[model samples]
Target: MPRMLPPGVGRRLRKGERIVLETHYHKTGRPEKDEGAEVALYFAKEPVEKMLHVHMLANVFLRIPPGSREHKVTASYTVPLDVTAYDVMPHMHLLGRRIAVTATFPDGRVQDLVRIEDWDFAWQETYQFKEPLRLPKGTKLRLEAVYDNSA
Candidate 1:
């Protein structure tokens, strides 16, 4: 289920804008059919002041050999502006073993954002922070994913 934004924060949709839905499907041994996903966009009744955006950190050209125990891939993004991050979602396929996200502030201090020692594709979901985290401009956000492609 998608989360709702707090009051005074909302995303504006332009007329005739395109919306894309990304879905992840898995097989359950038995043959089955997928009925697609249902999405709902709620309009704000009150005034909205903030707009929301999504930044993807991806290494799309990675290749891992079969039977590899611990193949690692990493990606990073530098923050161009100061912003508040409230939710984070990490994605990996079935062979994923672990994943971690960290941020290095401009002052050279590194902070652990999120880490999963054991990663399972079936249990993946968006993680909402207890409070919004402020990321300063020029902060480096790094993501490292480990894969165990052994059968």
Candidate 2:
């Protein structure tokens, strides 16, 4: 788990469900031997009222020309049902400088879910909101990012 959840909240898991873990090993320049690893699973002691789910938003298509700076990338998604979002995580690779996620309600109300004016790929982490947002149906999510391809 990247971050611990608050009490009474946990990842949804059904009875008799088996968790499949995936591991990625990188090649080192020098000779290396395999080391042992382990993972721990913790369940919520209290009844779970809310489940945490991760949804990734990404734009794979890009056409950044050589020596381009401030390249803009955008993507959006609409919610079909009501949801309460308590955490958000925005990711970008090298050359990314800015990113912002916003929500526009049906009634023309706008809310900033997450915004990073100075994006650093090394400082990626989940952001826990102090107050969970009640995103009603028909909420539109918009993501805009700026990348520097000047190199």
Candidate 3:
């Protein structure tokens, strides 16, 4: 006979749950430019544990055409998580403006994990949740970040 499994081992994320986030910039878009931008993540509002070195990730630079209203980029990764309070943030160069983390469920229900309207690459920090979030096995976490590459 097969061994019995633990309870709640494969449940989906429920309402009022919290999550932690770890982010890193693939690379510095402008290595020669000293006046560009820098990004990093922090835990517990402190710049120490779980910090990701930005240069380890890929980076790209672009010059948007005038009168252009479209620029899109996507990065995907799986975060190993347990039931705990957490926050999400995206680290980017000067172009970063907004960051959105969404949790999609198998039942089609979507949850806004976290959002930062004004993204400051200098003050990059992952705002932790006041409460721990419980995520079920079927939970699908996604991140969407918007940037303003124009200087």
Q: Give the best candidate by TM-score.
A: 1
Candidate 2's C-alpha runs over 4 A off are 14-39
lDDT of 1 by residue, 1-151 (tens): 7688878888889999999887777778898888878898899999898888888887999899988999999999999999989888898988899999999999999988889998988867888888898999999999999998887
Q: What does candidate 3's lDDT look like per residue over 90-122, in tens digits?
A: 566666677777776657788777777777777
For all candidates, the clash counts are: 0, 0, 13
| Model 2: per-residue Cα lDDT over 58-139, one tens digit each | 6878667779898999988898888888888887778889999999998899999999999987647678899878889999
- TM-score for all predictions? 0.88, 0.77, 0.48
Question: Rank order by lDDT, top first?
Answer: 1, 2, 3
> What are the clashing pairs of model 2?
none
- Steric clash pairs (candidate 1): none
> Per-residue error at 5 for model 1, in Å?
1.3
Better of 2 and 3 by lDDT: 2
User: What's the TM for model 2?
Assistant: 0.77
Where model 3 places Cα greater than 4 Å from the true spot, the runs are 1-69, 77-85
TM-score of 3: 0.48
Better of 1 and 3 by TM-score: 1
What is residue 18's positional error in candidate 2, in angstroms? 6.2
